[model samples]
Structure formats: C-alpha cells, structure tokens
Target: MPLSDKHPTVKRRRSQLLNHFLAFFVFAVIVVPVNFFTTPDHVWFFWPLVGWMGPLALHTAYAMGLFDRRD
Candidate 1:
C-alpha cells in the first residue's frame, strides 16, 4: 500500500531524505576538486559517490513506498 504523501511519517521521511541528499551534494562538491587536485592521476571521488548513492537510492525508493506491501 502506498502511503499517502501527506501522512506525517511519510512527510518526515522525505524531509530527512532531502536533507541527506543536500549534505551528500555538498560533500561531493568539496571532495571532487580536492581529490582531483591532490591526486590528479589517482582520481577516487567516484567511489564514495557510488557507495553513498546506492543506499540513498534505496532510501528514496523506500520513502516513495516502492517496497511497501499491498493491502
């Protein structure tokens, strides 16, 4: 069953997810240039981005009720 978006729990969950996404974006902005300048040949920023994004994607899906049971 898809939870109504107006539900308090769902609203809070999405709000928190938004905050996490913002933080991740900020982190990437800071890390990418630093990683590139510090280690020009050994670029490694993608690793962290992939690692965090996978779980965030899952969280987003969950918040969207993709995994919820049908009633």
Candidate 2:
C-alpha cells in the first residue's frame, strides 16, 4: 500500500522503519568497499542515505517539539 494509505499506527511504524533504513544506508555508504573496487567512483550509493535524512530530520524535529502540532 502507499505509505499515506497505511493506518495511523502502521504509518508511524513505517516512518520509524524508514528512519532506520536511512541510518543504515548512510552507514553502508561509508562502509561498503564499492568505491575502492569500481573503476569510476560513484556517489549514487549515498542516495538512500541522503533521501532518508529528510524523514529522519523531520522525525527528530517532531520529537524535539519543533513541529508543535498542538493536538
């Protein structure tokens, strides 16, 4: 299902999972040896990590009361 289509709790959990994936993706970008093995260096390996930072940052902001939804 589309992420927005999930139930509230499922959406929250999915958000958390996406956050973790982003965290792992960032780590993998630096840990993987693809840069050393590839003839032409590629930066695309960091895409997932970079993409994840947006959600992670927002989550952090929400957790820190920066969002202030007032609900």
Candidate 3:
C-alpha cells in the first residue's frame, strides 16, 4: 500500500526541512560576507557557524527520530 502524503508527520517534516534550508541559505549568503569584512584580522564566521551547527545537528537528529524514546 502507498503511504499517505497528507499525514501530519509528513507535512511537519516537509515544513521543517524547508525552514532549515532557508535559515542556512540566509546565513551563508548574508552573515558570512558581513562577518568577513567587519573583522578582516580574525575569521569570526566560525563563531556563528559553530553556534548554529550545534542546534542544527540536534534538530537533524530529532527530525530523523533518533532521539525518540523507545520504550
């Protein structure tokens, strides 16, 4: 049997993925360059990158059901 596309979980996952993509795109396009010129001496981009990556990683794990409590 084919899976139902209208399922709530499926819809939530789709929206979450789209949001993640948009956030990453905005950070790459705008934040990176701005940080590059604002402080030419040090590469401060890593600060934001490291900050965002932590949460992003957790979000990925949760979305993949890795953190689901299996009883």
The best candidate in terms of TM-score = 1
Error of 3 at 66 (Å): 1.1
Give per-model TM-scores: 0.85, 0.42, 0.72
Candidate 2 lDDT for residue 53 = 74
lDDT for model 1 comes to 0.90
Kindly list the per-residue Cα lDDT of model 2 for residues 1-71, writing each as its tens digit: 22244468556765876777677766776745675467346645566566767877777665444555554
| Model 1, residue pairs in steric clash | 1-69
Regions of model 3 farther than 4 Å from truth: 1-6
Error of 2 at 15 (Å): 14
Scored against the true structure, residue 40 in model 2 reaches a CA lDDT of 42
Task: Decide which is better by TM-score, 1 or 2.
Answer: 1
In what order do the candidates fall by TM-score, top score first?
1, 3, 2
The better candidate by TM-score, 1 or 3, is 1
How high is the lDDT of residue 70 in model 1?
84
Model 1 lDDT per residue over 1-71, tens place: 55677999899989988998998999999999999899989989999999999989998988887887786
- Listed per model in order, the count of residue pairs whose N, CA or C atoms clash below 3 Å is 1, 0, 0
Which candidate do you rate higher for TM-score, 2 or 3?
3
Residue 25 in candidate 3, Cα distance off native in Å:
2.4
Error of 2 at 3 (Å): 30
